[model samples]
Target: MKKNQVVLFPVLLALFVFTSCNAQKNIPVFSKVVYEGNDDIYNENPLKADEFYNPILQGTYPDPAIARKGNDYYLVASSFAMVPGVPIFHSNDLVNWVQIGHVLDRKTQLKVHDTGISASIYAPDIRYNPYNDTFYMIVTQFAGGFGNMVVKTKDPREGWSDPIKLDFQGIDPAIFFDDDGKAYVVHNDAPNKGEELYQGHRVIKIWEYDLEKDQVVPGTDKIIVNGGVDLSKKPIWIEAPHIYKKDGLYYLMCAEGGTGGWHSEVIFVSDNPMGPYEPAPSNPILTQRHFPGNRENKVDWVGHADLVVGPDDKYYGVFLGIRPNDKDRVNTGRETFILPVDWSGKFPVFENGLVPMEPTLKLPEGVEYKAGEGEFFPNGNFTYSEDFNSEKLDYRWIGLRGPREDFIEITKKGLKINPFEVNIKEVKPTSTLFHRQQHKDFSFTTTLEYKPKSEKELAGITAVQSEKFNYVFGVTRKDKKHFIVLERTEKGSSKILASKEIDFKEKIQLKVEAEGDDYKFSYALNGGDFENLGGTVSGDILSTNVA
Candidate 1:
């Protein structure tokens, strides 16, 4: 399959028969079909583990915390207002990963405009302090509905220390430093406004901080854990805590109900690092127990974990799951997934704890770049159509907020973008033309040539997840010809299933393929034979935080 994959093999066999009829209706039945030189779809090198096997980091929007520093492992997601807000990823073996740089590129440390999509910086947590090698970080701007912030660094790559505010009102803070030195700081509380509190169902605290006086000691704020297990079952909105101690006891791990679906959940403990912490009679640990009549175990929003240990010491957790590929709108975002935690008499378990991250023979030893190997570019298979002349922007492009210098220019014959008018329903934080959701069953083609002056000068190709679920697929303008819609949009609702009648002046190529959540669109005109424009999407577009 060379020569442009044999001219993209009849458009990838009509998108592999509409992804084998949407994978026989929403995956699992031993879902298979991974391709390209398989070896379980390209041995774990930099974790694309054949495109997504229980998320151990896939693409787009990775979220809050995961750190390990001895054999090297670091992770720091949540790029909320996007521009270079947090990112950082490096792995020695926690199942391959790469990207290493980004922790709020100093715009005075984070501005986050309209803050949409669950309000910007929420839950960060990263730590590394070999007696002072330093590298603490603690986010939570939650649109500043209240305080919770901190940043420090010895050098995870220059510049950090700024946003200091921390009187702590709520929204995932976590910081535990004990060994003999003592310095706790768990979080989540800020409900009481007649209680529908941001759906995190409220209550769960633990203070005592003062990294040499950064604050939080006045009355020491400790409520260890509340919202009594099942008060009619509502108050489980505890946020992303994390506290680890083990052996002498002190566990804590958090995240419960309300990250969306399957009722999130992760709860943990043994306790006494400070408080009567208990809750672990095999608590929710994970869910989605095979959905058929279970409906993917009804709303599987599998917690926001983050433990670590491996290199053989065992105990690995990593969390975040969202599975509803297409049917009924779950829009694929929130991915990161790695699990293995047993413990035995103290209890932990989790192997089929809700099924999803399968497909692992063990890979992760390294050295295997496949897909055109090395320094990229046309050498392997990179073709945003003749490269589109890149000037910078290409870690496989990603922007849906934060990215300006006049949003895109690139020349030598392509990429222009420059029309910004905001209000695709009150826009949110800015930046568009996204990318990252790499291969959940690949194929995303692009080719545009607009010459419009009016009719809202639109252009196409989108899949997006935050303008509240997307679809788009080009060509508009009604009465004067040029039609060829697809639309979709959600939450704010806008449907256009399919459309026709075109002749938009000239150049047209537009193509889409997707696979998992089902996608297929085509066009050719002036190169010939492509047509098909009927639409079908399934669900999950990639941004319920981490995908």
Candidate 2:
């Protein structure tokens, strides 16, 4: 019926790591975070004028939900248990996006202080209502006993109000404001009691929303799209319901066939928003399932899209897509992609969405594409180096489950961390900070000025996808000798692949490099040559697939 949705480590020489897990009594600190993207695909097809990259916002930003207000375009994506949930982005041109802030930034707004990595916000929707002159963000908090919630703000940049918990029980909830000033909320819901015809059977439901009360009116909900385009086909996981009205007809769009290779975007039409809807002739307007498994530049699992009128006054869409490596593994997680929609016909069709997607597209007028850090959201090949000198950390550097400020602090020296007593198998937030893996071939190295006096104390670098799926590479003490180790955790099982005795020293450079599925963790002594601790290992376990 519904959906949803982690990060680490010590600093001063500064730069590093996801959900933290340890049975130690020590806390660690880190200084800076340096990430570089060197995908072979980006090298093969460099960015050229009149063309832009597919994912304007990269590195695990998935389940995209978008809305446009005049010249300002606002987009949101699923954050799961990551603190400061609901990462909100802004772009007037759509091609150049910059994250403004999180809608759930305050402690009162995000209650998943100790929830699992897979719980919290899921497939969130952001809409601007001209009638109320307010922006509404509705979502399902799968943790903290908050089933579904909505938050509003006059201006998102200034911050959002506390969430108005909606009395509903579904995920992927969205609100649509009609031209007549009436508002309606739609989301994916489970079949009533035992009516589930097959596995993954679900229904899209809509309810009359009370603007003043900021909740759904009692007993006015209706199931808009049941089991997807054709119930006879028994479509599975029909979710991410969004409603739009154009030319006196209500258009409902949703994602079907789960969030895997079978994923596709479907559309329906009705005379009313709460209706008996009809599937479009071109039911699946967007998908990559038809493409071969061995195709180059593979972008699989494409769906869960949202549409918006671009600055050019043309229809454009932002959707979730996966760019699996040659090994057919997802390490970067689901990313957000954009495409122009051809709505001049009877129904809308995603241009080139059904076909094998190209990595690049000719730029539209008034659209600007730029890579690297700064105002334009980095795409293509770029380098991001962050020094924790400012009071405010980059929005990209976030915490897992708990607030980052609780464990990490920004100071003139570097980012400091006060680790919590997190026992192995304990459900608690880690003393860590995190940045997403942006490319298949990239290097992330941070100088760690640390030494573990005891066996429990450690400080190094790591690649963490969640509490149960991750790799830890750091230094620890054993038998009065300093040693470094590489550990891997997959689906709750963990094992140490390699450990070596080493002379302790400050300013140890810890690095993790990757090429497609192969990952190698290494260390250097006081700017010495990097020593490979673990033989190149497979990174298949580092995936956040909601399959």
Candidate 3:
């Protein structure tokens, strides 16, 4: 147990020291990646017995929202504006995960402290009502005072409960629990269009919950699916809903053409969870947006699905997809795959033929394949080099609205941020610290050495998706000369795009090189040869459908 934690500030000379270590096997947890152009389909290592892997939860970890409380299998995602947003992974074997907490860890449970990077938290579900043992979730607080909320936890690793807003207006929220135990929430309602109609006309409400008094049961609020799943070709943003109940029949699912490149995944049915349902005769059941090689393999935005059932009973599906690296270059953002369903029809489809997202399969029968658990699961051609030497910051390092701690510090000569007199187009917390473009041709390199007391204090390395959409690449000190810049922003507006005047400095090494979402950037001044620093930089405008 190598633990050391420290955090001095003394008027901001800051000296963090958090050094904890354990999963090391020469740094191998997960690494086998291939499928950018499909090298022959690699990805494997779901603990290894007959393999398993296809994101399984890597990088951005978008939308996903699984549950299941007996043999354990939590899962949660979409922590926009990342703070202690939603992120509660634990898996007995839905491809071996591990994160344990974060359902909105305090900050007054984030009732909007100035959110932006695409607004605070949206799309989350995760339920598990064991008739009230508790563990709900239901979210969608996109922006200050937006609606739908709910949090609970008899003990989701050890925290939660405090957000119970939900008067309900819309945005991917879900709850559904029935067998007479009754509990419903299902959302995504606002999209009326009294005008010309045809921009993903949406609607799909339903509410009836009074788990004692926790709200939503006012007028039963029903509207079970309206403009989506073939409204005569006017389907977009049917949104992530989910409702499942199998056999006695209730299904519902969602995610229509809106997360880009026409995302898909329809479905409907129902003996009665609310009203007359019918759609799924294979209605957009699952889609790689019509994957016919998807422009010769760039993958394309796959639906948002959610279903779960395992403990060997099988049937899985978690969604959100991306891995474009080029044309509309998606710098590995929306992630978390894993399909394999086919519950013998009537609903759960997608077991074969989906397009770009099947890198390996098999492993699900009763789990027990413990060969090594891939050391600790972070590999997709492992190159995630951090080097802050521990002391804190590696829950896949994110930041913007939720990480300012006076601008982070991890001393030992690495991972130390600082620049915040307001810079990256200032939406606020701009000391920047990303990390979630996990693949699609990687390489991030850092090594900055900062000493900028002037030129507005710019300390390097950025790729942010907020604070006005980023690109940065740093080093400052103007007039006295010491440049190497290159900026981008675009929404809150900023420009530079390339600079260069360095003859010396405190240190410099910068590098980005993504290669599909096109990044390039490069520096290497005290060590040499990275030096490109010009062109490239698209990343399809960051993403989540152009943040």
lDDT, candidate 2, 56-126, per-residue tens: 77777888988888899999998887788989999888887889999899888888877766678888999
Report the lDDT tens digits of candidate 3 across residue range 261-335.
Answer: 777788888899886677877677678766564464455577787888877787888887776544655555777
> Which prediction has the highest lDDT against the true structure?
2
Q: In model 1, which runs have C-alpha deviations exceeding 4 angstroms?
A: 1-77, 84-137, 140-183, 186-208, 215-251, 255-279, 290-298, 305-321, 326-331, 335-402, 408-432, 435-503, 506-516, 522-547
User: In candidate 1, what are the lDDT values of residues 1-547, reduced to their tens digit?
Assistant: 0011000000111010011111222211101112221122324433444432345554444444777778877778766655556777666666656666677665567666556544566668888767667878887765534357888878776767777888867667878788877687888775456755333356778888887886778787877776534536665566677888778877786766556554444555664777777777666766653455334222355666767776777777777665444343344355566777765556465666565445432443442333232332111112332345657644435444455434556665566555555534345533244554433445555556553433443456666555555566666565565776766667767787888877745566677665555667777766677786885555344334222
lDDT for model 1 comes to 0.57
TM-score of structure candidate 2:
0.94
Clashes of each: 17, 14, 9
